[model samples]
Target: MCFSMFRSKSKNSSIIQPGKFTPSNTNINPTALNSPSSRSHSQSKSRSNEFNSKSSSISSRASLSSLKDSLPENPHIYDLSEIRSATSNFLLRPFSSSSSSTSWKCLIDKKQLIVTQRKLRRPIDNSELRRKLSLLCKSHHASLVKLHGASVSGNYLYLVYEFICGANLSDCLRNPRNPNFTVLSNWISRVQIIAGIADGLDYMHNCAGFKNGFIHNHVKSSSIVICEEPALVAKICHFGTAQLCGEVPEAISGEDDDDSSNYHVLKRVGSAVGKFVGTRGYMSPEFQTTGIPTLKSDVFAFGVVLLELLSGEEPMKVHVDSGSGAFRKVSLIETAREAVGSGTGRLRQWVDRRLRDSYPVEVADGLARVALECVLEDPGRRPDMGRVAGWISKYYLESKTWAQNIGLPDEITVSFAPR
Candidate 1:
């Protein structure tokens, strides 16, 4: 009977009931499980596990934040369909008739942007194009028009830039309806415009930190816009068009003789197809010959623009000879050289008469001399954009001081009464 009772007890222990707890069957102690000290220990263990989980979650979030910070801010590569939809199937009229490239002012994602269409001069690899776009988009300056993004379709690229509300330097300087009137009426206003442009160019040449130096291939009065309200701010347009459209020649570095020669031939042929469209008076002698744009060429264009700012005249115009009644081309550069060389009051006379003798003669002379230095026939002889910008900045300060001393208002306001 004792042996049978022991067997029954062992069998009952093996068959554990669902809701019944036994210390012999389970590793847990029944007395300790219900004790206050044991319950305290259990609560402590649960709290510690919860604290560790929170810490792990915070650590994971920190790691993810760091990863995001390390990555570059890549520009949006838009789908062709998005561009088409925004542009209403390409039926929108161009923003400006004078623009060499077709551009449309359209809204995308509730933001106004200027979309310029450019034909690709050469095929670019997809990865390589994205890399270049990222670098270009990363560059920013107050005086530069921001390139938001780009879209590609087959052989064309649509570059989107933030639309700035202002008049271009060309129209501001010369009003078609009123030739005698100019929005840049005062000397201080003109100084402000040129100074902003100089600062912007200096940033692109020296400070942009591009692997290959950035070049603003199109630097003309027409390509610069002047924001009149708030302040006279100059913003350069077409910041990365050259690189994006493959207009920048590989021979720009002068690394290979054969490549340079081939680039010249290609540029000459491509000019017919609108691949190369340099402004009439802005092209430097070297740029005209080699068809390769460099930093120095940009300096040359800036010089021309400076002269246009100083003297309210077209870059190139026809002067009819009184003696023979024959038309001959008279370049502003030639007149500027003569005015500076004459050593008389001719420079003062050469300056825009609309200034009404309000500007400081000394400052004007110095600025003209700086412009001349930039237009030297030999690109090697011309000063770099950095040096030129520094000179202009100094002149700008002097002009401001002159304006203040003379009690000339920094800005001119125009109002019209109802006719």
Candidate 2:
């Protein structure tokens, strides 16, 4: 009977415990130990401490797990359909806000949609990007493009931006139908453009603590957009490839090539392979060689852009159709040399044929000189954006004076100073 009673007690204990276990030394059931009446006061106090410890540990783990979920693990791609629908089919809609990093616009339903898909495997350390974007959004200026808002959902990010409705400076230069096509943009317009660009750059350099290292890197005909005023409104875009002002090689990509023919072709032409990180002809020699991009690097690209505006020829095109020989491989600089060697008046011949009849030669010459100085081989020798802005402004003022002195028709005056 004693043995039978022992077996029944063991079965009862198993039923009560289920998955939970009590120490052999503890005569009390672990669950029962928690009840106030089941344990002595001292034991009850100890049991409470144990329960609190367990609860605290579980709470900490849950908090940590939740924190991890908030960060994006990868760049999430959305269906193009989703993007289209969210954007209300890209139909005309007003946006309450905008940002350059992503596209946001109103849809038919009047709800705003942000479209940004992260391209990189790792998410951009967004703290820096956010800080910069914030600064850009707050500042108001003519040259800088406007920023609206940012969208973040999981790994998806979108930047809403104001849509600019005008031809990029490059399109204006290359357009055969543009009446003002070849003339060096009137001295006034060029100056205004230059000054406005400087103001934007100045703010970028100093106001946001963004001085020194970051460069627009890609300055070309297509980069600058002209507004209704026919103003050379510089819309600096594409910060994706921007080099950090003070960081290591981790920030940039490296490429390798060993084509002597390509090298020879570039050398003869006074430009680089013009591939990879920057536009081929516009990149500085240093950027081509060492990846040492900086403010001076941007100045070099800007100089090339100015030259294109004046000359109306692609910087690398000078080498494109040359007759077979070392002459065929002649670099842009050499090509310019050959053209100039023809005569002092030959410089006028090199200007875009389209603008030949309309542009003032003196204005063209001045801008050309500025371009040359901007593209100097030594970064230190290149003029700062401030100086360039000032020079352009002066030229613009002088052109206005020249136009008035000649008693040009009202159309000419209005064209020079558009409302």
Candidate 3:
């Protein structure tokens, strides 16, 4: 887990009330994100000023090329000069409002690409972090965005990914630039969105190589981007906060922490501020207390994203009628549980109104039930992402076009073959 959660509550008190929903209560400024737009270069000065200064004696390109040699052979090590030239001087288009990394829409050999730049908050052994990065780069699943190249320096690390030009799921659902962009309309599509994400996480947690597997650590609605170019599908991006299981530095986890063994898997996450890196609402109660993340933690985050997709609400803020004043801020998880407990009419209040008559009541009920189990306060009680994937598959397969829309071949298999 990378970010802070429940700072005001004590370790004991931070525990989830048996059946309450808590929104990821971050004071996020949503508009700070530049909406993934591509623009002409204000970045040109970066080549002469930034890289030139960084590389005074030898060429900047030569310095960057040397860094590239250490990584797995596939990804190119572009010179800082090349990157600055491509992005017009490191003027980044925001990827997410909360993202600490800066990104630019770049063109290489006439192909449009997205390059993200980040600096390590603390020094990490280049070999150790690079090995993990290479695993993700090589582990290409359709739902996982492809890594084009990378440059990992102790000061600043560069990551290049395929730019899925479509809007992120967060913007597409709640604050869509176009009111007509109804890609998230029906139950099948929404279910497909959840399934696609589950598939990617399944692969990462199980298939991605690590002695203990990898954890996305940061899973949320905004982290998911929906692509419509070749087909309609959702993909996860911004791996800047993700970490390998059981590899946390002792200093970050604190040797005296009770969950120290399980907490071993964390990263300093490139922040001078030194707080945890994940959103509060999506974090599992145990992780909030212990600072240790397991595959189950990711499952909990997915559950929150599922709730967001189902309800068409932001994970950070949900409104409840306070009776005395304006709608008070209630956690989305708490609201979800209450909505499910109360009758169908109450549930409808939380459901995204945009779906209108398109959603099937039985399917909605099934989703709520599954999602409820996912957000369970007890980590052991939560289903693994593999089983989570299975639970949502049958309902999604009900739509034949759905598979084709997400670019899955005909006769696709929906079960998770977890190891």
Best by TM-score: 1
lDDT of each: 0.78, 0.51, 0.64
Measured against the true structure, the TM-scores of the candidates, in listed sequence, are 0.76, 0.57, 0.67
Give lDDT tens digits, candidate 2, residues 1-419. Answer: 00000001110012453686675774756787586676687587789888998998899899889978743233222344555667765463533222322234443224333333332222344565465455445544455444444434444455443455455566555656765553234544544455455555544544434433345555666656555433234555433234321111233322226421111111112333333345668878877786545666777787777666656666675344546533343334434554545654887787666543454567666766777777888776777666676676667666666666766321221131224
Clashing pairs in 1: none
Clashes of 2: 20
Shift of residue 240 alpha carbon in model 3, Å = 6.3
lDDT of 1 by residue, 330-364 (tens): 99999999998886499988998888888988889
Q: Hey, what RMSD does candidate 1 come out at? A: 20.8
Once model 1 is optimally superposed onto the true structure by TM-score, how far is the C-alpha of residue 93 displaced, in angstroms?
1.4
Of the two candidates 1 and 3, the one with more favorable lDDT, higher being better, is: 1
- What is the C-alpha lDDT profile of model 3 across 1-419, one tens digit per residue? 01101112211112565877687868955654444331123256545677778677567678778878744346455567777778777665554334556777768656667777766545555565566566666766667776666665447767767666666777767754566445566566677677778877877776667555566776887778775423346777765345422223333423325441232334445434344555758888878876656677888889889888888877667466668567666788888889889978888878888877556666677787888888888776677776777777766655445446655453322211124
